[model samples]
Target: MKLVTRAGWGAAPSRYDLAYIASTHGTKIHYEGAYVPKSLAAPGAHGSCAGHVRDIQASHLANRVENYSDIAYSAMVCPHGTVYEGRGLHRQTGANGDQLLNRAHYAVCAMLGNSGLVVPTDAMLDGLVDAIGWLRNGGGAGKEVLGHRDGYATACPGDPLYAWVQAGAKRPDGTAPQGGTSTPVPSSGGIARYQVVINGLSYGYGAQGPHVAEVGKALVKAGYGKHYQVGPDENWTDADTKNFSDFQRSLGFTGTAPHQDADGVPGPVSLQRLLGHLPGKTVKAYGMLPFPGRSAFVLGKSNPAVVTLDNGLIRKGYARHHAGAKYQPGSLFTTYTRDNVRDFQRATPALAGDADGYPGPLTWQLLLS
Candidate 1:
């Protein structure tokens, strides 16, 4: 429940003036959605929390595509029960899907990610509760406390944290503030049927495709591409296998045994860890356009799905709001694209209630179809 000011964390000056909100629908919980070092969760590592927050700010600022004015969240909580001020108080958040969605809730990010330090300590959960209470009391946040994926197609805030949100964001002592509800999990709009399957056999010797390229790129990003001699392109060469084996070893998998974890064959668990953050169809899956998850269309995200969305909007004649004389369809999801999606949602009776400017699975399907 300790609070750290932005100055204490050495936050850089925000690039743009943050918009203020008089009130919010509630507080939406979030997590890093990427890898976080295990050291951050260790005891007595509280001193490093500020640096971690600062690093997050640096990353957000460096995201040229998102063009984020500041670190997207209103506040951040560490595992040691310290709350760091981000774009604090009534300021609008960029972490949510779009402007409309941003206006609907304040964002609180738990300093946890998918890999390494995935689980939250009891202290962290208590810190989250304290952060939410602070928002409700002074930030005009409503009674509702929800996860980042409540209305968006994301696995953000991850399952463990989101489960806490759904369970009313209770503290470790089993006490929660009044007016919290168990928010139902949102529908994926049939997104469950599609998956990014990396067939183990398809890799190693002579395999080639966008999927191979994706694995190669992931391997490089994960710091295991040291064996690469030429290309991490479409061709899956010995480099891919060697690099993948290194990644497996890092995960404590050794010897090409019964599990094949170290065989460099790209098992489901290792691949998911390496590329879980990647949304949309990075690999060609028989020409199927997977829903790409709702997070792909959020402001600041630049993904292939955004490009598809832009093209679909234009084809559907929703281009009036986004397309200009010099405008060309691109990957970046900006306010213009959001407004266009909103326009489409308003025009379509099926989407009228769900029009928050962010494209959900149904919106994507309808627009493209």
Candidate 2:
């Protein structure tokens, strides 16, 4: 990951007061909070995240609303796997609200779009992890990795990114897919989920199926499928295991056991990270898993998971009751949520008789998928 210094990018002179605060508690991930098309973000585009860093600074200076000392983030991650320095590692940011909170952690903003608009590409996420690693090792930062919403009440980083963070934010290069593919088959380099179930052997060595092939695809995307000298196949060989293990090591999941070890089994967390979606909480379900700790939810409930479920149902074509404007992320469960759940349940053959207007486990699994 290459970093573009402020000077290297020809940033304007400072306009506000700057504070010198060393290492922060951890890092808070952020997004642009508005839809930014890929066309605008493509590498070398005049509107790419790299090109907009200075525009953001100018906005901060003119938006009197913030009038921040400088750019609001410590660093920014561009879509093309590049890091551009903002206020550097030592300065406080206007990202976290109060000055006290600003001192709590330095912020890193990924040039991401608003929720439901765009998902962070693996390259962008890889750049983010690399940036975080650099902060912890060389830029004077602690170890906790969190989203902007983790501290603030607003959903600054959005669901896809937040869920990525919640899943231990495992680095992409850390592990390989366990094995699965059920979603629409993606192009050679796209992330896909295949049908996979661990009976006893845990999909390793001799596993042969579309799932195994899915794992290989994920591995190659992470730059760890070197074992497949020819191409990704439905076989999990020793070479595949070794390369997969290297990925596990990268995700801080190293050990010496099967379930406990970061072996070839592409556990839920690791695989979800690699596949770019949350398939299940602990296992791969054919749908969206509930927010980290939610089992079920109903009307009047105010929780982030509720927002996630609401959005998941919407994505699955079950949000008809929401009218033109849908329930926003980070919103409380209401008629909109309940109706969406019931509608979703009624659509699935297996769930038709159980449309209870509540996001139960099975419904959540299918909805998220």
Candidate 3:
């Protein structure tokens, strides 16, 4: 158990906006699973998260493509006492096999692999203890930390590291470790699910219920389209299904079994797909706008004014949804909405008006300008 320290790589994102993606119901620990060299025990040879990042960058350059924007792990504890931040401590990353768990779990990875000869240093172990403490006390990670091998196939985090992590490190109250009860695994929220990321943002749609509105809401949240407000009493209509289906197709998805007729009725396959349990990799359906009859436009009426208005606003960066020709419910405003609309009006003088900056005809014209 030797401590090795190193310097920062200076390439990790400094802002939380890019760092935090989503929260985990729990946290999972991982080891690189690669063989660690004895040199890692040497004080001068210990590398920081930044050093690992450099290696990753070099690997990517050699491979001629980027595997990920940063190291796949959220946090990487070095052999020394230094904790190099890998991924942000807040978001779920793609380092685990449990798709649903990965979406909700904040993952932490240690640098050395635990294959056989790889030995984690004392400093790395200490850093792990500190991180677990922070997650439990400050980060709200109560009983929600697990190892990679808990639910997935394969031995991860190694036997020694896993045992060490499970041993009561410290309670939230700074009490001694209570090695009685096993730490609880994070809730999966029911069925396992996959996530869809569009334009670099993941829509938080989990594999839970299949309500069109809910699915649509997730799409909107993921920056895909507007919110969809189809009635829960009735199934999705063919038109509704078609619109969603078409959106998925645009994202390179194939066709599914018919689940609805001409009227807004949902069929089985459509319902299944809506639930996110459809077989294989399905294209993510963009959410619908939350306005009345907006989703029904293509199936019924075509309002060019609203269409152009929506498109213009989207072009001017006022709205988020532009996936389908029609708009969904949640396609209204973004966090920087006021600035986006105000800037559009301010930048163009031809249609100057002290409007509240809502997306309407006047706003649309200003946006066009």
Candidate 4:
């Protein structure tokens, strides 16, 4: 099972140190209890899971009523079987209603919510078992495993999860304790396969296509079509370029070298950020860069693909290891580059299992796309 440390996820520091508890009654299962985006469950979209946890922590901290010191849950489990440390071991959780209930058990939240991606995956079940076992063995927790609603008034951990709790939190292979009949785990199925790719050459003076119109429409929807005198159409114009440049600038692409460019030509990353959220379509740019084989990214090897990979990591906000003055990102595939790649792999669900600090084909495709 993959474990993502708080640092790996870019979590904010807690407002205060959490009070330590030697032991608890057991682990209490919790769910998001709201509408979760189906996009989050997509194959290559698991990198956003860390952002979700951070958002939860931000919300908890900003809640005037709860006054939570950090994220309410002790830890969070994603559908991809990755465990994220929240207010980790030995800390009192603020999720289970009041003080007494909080003290009684450590909290483990499934990324599932009431609406989208509600069904728990087999991997998710395994992750839950991992978290529960970790708490029991290392955190001094007892044998009891419970849903959030077991002692609280509100319905949490929802029906499916509550049912799982009642069945003694059995593992997917039925290895753990069991009680009532086991509930069949459902599939988390909202991945959009086809991605809209806007050709970079599709813009400028003579360029014209349905794709251009689509880009204009997306730009209008994203509030970046202010330069449009008449609105988006098939024919590409300077207005489209100006508006696209503005959109690119919004993504912090203000230069024109290596990978940083706000030249109004839609790059894969910027284009995806602009239109990836559209209901049923993922988005990318044309000229989809092919992955240079793994041999190109090794210690002491200097390749342009390394630059591309590093830039992708930088765009994904995973460049801290190499962003320092001592060793900046370049063509050389150094330890700094490898470490950053490892961090990216650890955060991305599809790549977490093979986070060996080396770029594989899947990792390359996902990072660039």
Candidate 5:
């Protein structure tokens, strides 16, 4: 089997080694035996890579931590065509049947397990061919690869895919290998927001009602509004209108008509600006910095030089911890006041002149960078 490191793949038992050789008597072919989306593969075929393999590994580890006994397989074949060594071929996994049949068996899991997502990817098939060839040839005592349900009661490895496994194929030199094509790096662009915690409270960016107080606070700090109030009920109020008005004004709307309840309530255009829809305005947020600390806001415009300087420092790991969606230091204008700014200016040589500490463009640049 082709074993290498990649995302979704880091666990234990790095690769097939002498430790594995001693314990494993033969090879057992089992499907992660789960289902996966077709998008997992390339456009034309089911070509997988180390990255895809790693995703499966990460999920498996997460699953094991949640409920299972241990990682379910000895090794797995990602759609990317990479084989990952599970608990090593030597260490026994609880994925197989009773002890007698489990020992001496090297299990290989096909990514996506057996959930019934789609036809197996060609790359996955190639991986299967390569893995079987390696197990049958390299292990000396050649053995047959079987589905999970073959010995157990469950319909593991699914029906359609498992049927194909029952019919074996031959190998030349007992190995299959091929080159790979390029694929784009995965991004979390459209992912759904999960409950993000802040100051011991649970909230989501898309949530509504009292939860919106946090969102409103984020908006105000981001420079979308000026008026913010803490109600007797501790809930956010329409003081958010100021932010909506500021955003609307930025869009070129003029006079009282712009602020009027023309559409009854705030429209999508208004919300869009709050969410950074409109262009040019700089929106400052608390960032992912940890609590009990202060977050800096870079105002005016987004200067590339400033941004680059800040990012460089962040990359070097000097900035405060990431707070996700929470704000800290309470009132930026008050808590930071003069003392905080003076302290910051004193500590950082980047700010030469006034120890006044009030962070203007240059001061903010120096402090953030």
Candidate 6:
């Protein structure tokens, strides 16, 4: 039951906004409905699996929705027992034949089918079961795992796999492993707008609205902000300029002249640099520092880097001062965030030994996963 996260799969992002809200109705299974040689299904053959998804998305965007940002499946399982994240946790997928019906359930596609030549091995079946289990628990899915034929007028998920889906998509005992997220590295393409949203893609004096606030928040994250004693806000003042310029210069930028000193204006280059590593909980949100600075996240640190850790903690249901308390959005790190990071580190097998409440590179990777 090994799982490959979205980043691990090296997916090319969609050019469309993610607007679909997922349902808890259960999972619908499907297949590529075409032949893929067994060699593509070999163990660790992640390249083949990723390539297959990309090709399908190209077809889906061109023929299905004409501008669909991504592939139709919520996720896909390979014959090697690895699950590749597709549209991720939220966002409605374009799989269902009925556009309005796409909200009924999540989609899981096992990379097989069409020519009826590739058979699903025992490992592949177990992988599929594990994929369903992960989606059911992690992404708020229900228990009624069914094939595409169950809800749509299509002979999808294929016959043999369809029968397996009906048989509860159960795995043999102890066959599945927990999903994985590896250490962070550069993404394969341009940074996702969802990952970082700046107003008009830049910020300066007189900018107002959520985008201005986003810039202020980013400034706060970078250990800047001489004026945000109460927290960053939408109003752009001289303090914003000072802090932004300080942050810009900190990145090694030095503007000279009567109007020198980096100017505190967030052009595209500086703005992307300040986003750090914080990802929004939903689509189309303004972003933060692109690179959170070059330090390990720890307690007592009150910067944009803390926001990165806080976002991760919030996502896994471990954030908040106490039970039933909502996390203060873009707030400074508190005891609660630290404790949750420690708890998550302790819980993760790969990170159990390093559960010191200080989120390093590996911790961020796992949290993103």
Instruction: List the candidate 5 regions with Cα displacement exceeding 4 Å.
Output: 5-8, 12-25, 43-70, 113-116, 137-141, 170-369
Best by TM-score: 1
Ranking of all predicted structures according to TM-score, beginning with the best and ending with the worst:
1, 4, 2, 6, 3, 5
lDDT of 3 by residue, 1-369 (tens): 121222345553322243354345666778766333223444654432344544543332333243344456666666665555555556556577655766766666766543212345556656765665555554555566678787888567765566655665333333432352223222233211222222122222232234445545434444434323543212332223334444444332332322111111222222233444322233322212111111112222222223333445555555543345633323233323434455566666743566444343334424544
TM-score for each predicted model, relative to the true structure = 0.53, 0.47, 0.40, 0.51, 0.39, 0.45
lDDT of 6: 0.59
User: What is candidate 3's TM-score against the reference?
Assistant: 0.40
True lDDT of residue 264, candidate 1: 62
Residues 121-227, candidate 1: write the lDDT tens digits. Answer: 78888788888888888899998888999888888887667777777788766788643433322213211111112322244446677778988998888788899
Query: Model 6: residues >4 Å from true position, as ranges?
Result: 43-47, 64-66, 173-369
**Ranking of all candidate structures by their lDDT, best first:** 1, 4, 2, 6, 3, 5
Pick by TM-score: 5 or 6, better one: 6
Off by over 4 Å in 1: 178-369
Q: RMSD to the native, candidate 1?
A: 16.1
Error of 3 at 113 (Å): 1.8
lDDT of 4 by residue, 159-253 (tens): 67778788878877887744453486321121111111222233433457776788799999999999999999988666776787788667654
Tell me the whole-model lDDT of each prediction, alpha carbons only.
0.72, 0.61, 0.44, 0.71, 0.43, 0.59
Worst 10 residues of 6 by lDDT: 188-197
CA RMSD (A), model 3: 19.3
In angstroms, the error of model 4 at 367 is 29
